[model samples]
Target: MIEGALGDLRNGVSRIAHNEKIEELQSEFSGDKPHLQHSKPLHLDPMFYEALDVLHYVEPTCLAAFLKLSQFMHRVEDVPNTKAYMESDRIIKWPPNRW
Candidate 1:
């Protein structure tokens, strides 16, 4: 459980026997943002909160859903526009550090 961030993977999980490659980082989330502007900020983009939500509760409703969602998430990372999406403030950028 990435605290449910990738819970879908668990659901879609199977005894089907297959092969896939997943890139798990040494840490669940990475990157460091340290700057003077970090002065106890009072506000953050709504997308930021949405990002956290996906990170918090993305478990699968079923095992099929889990496998499907995992492939979907993996595919999302493979899209040509992924770099752009990650840089932008879109829900697509959910799981900021993990993705």
Candidate 2:
């Protein structure tokens, strides 16, 4: 009985953590302005949804997977501009150039 109860608690925590990840992923692709994310609805990408399907099933509380996917999503989102920034060495510039 105690084992069953512990299992329930673990599942609950897992769902909550997964929910947070979903919300985070949603927020990642939400709006034009980063500051406007809160006002927008989720705009998750197909890749995110696909990855979620695989990860959530394997381990609902898989933080490591979430982080990896999150990082990839961030990179994917920034590719166009980020590529230029990287080639320009701005990413490594100390006292980052004034806008």
The 10 consecutive residues of candidate 2 with the worst lDDT sum are: 33-42
Candidate 1 segments exceeding 4 Å error: 1-65, 87-99
Write candidate 1's Cα lDDT for 1-99 as tens digits.
575855554433321212132212201121132211232222342223333234335533332434433443443444456546656787353334442
- RMSD over all Cα atoms, model 2: 13.2
**TM-score of each model, paired residue for residue:** 0.25, 0.25
lDDT of 2 by residue, 38-94 (tens): 332134443343344344555756646555455544554455654576578546533
Q: What's each prediction's clash count?
A: 3, 0
Model 1's alpha-carbon lDDT is 0.35
Report the alpha-carbon TM-score of model 1 versus the true structure.
Answer: 0.25
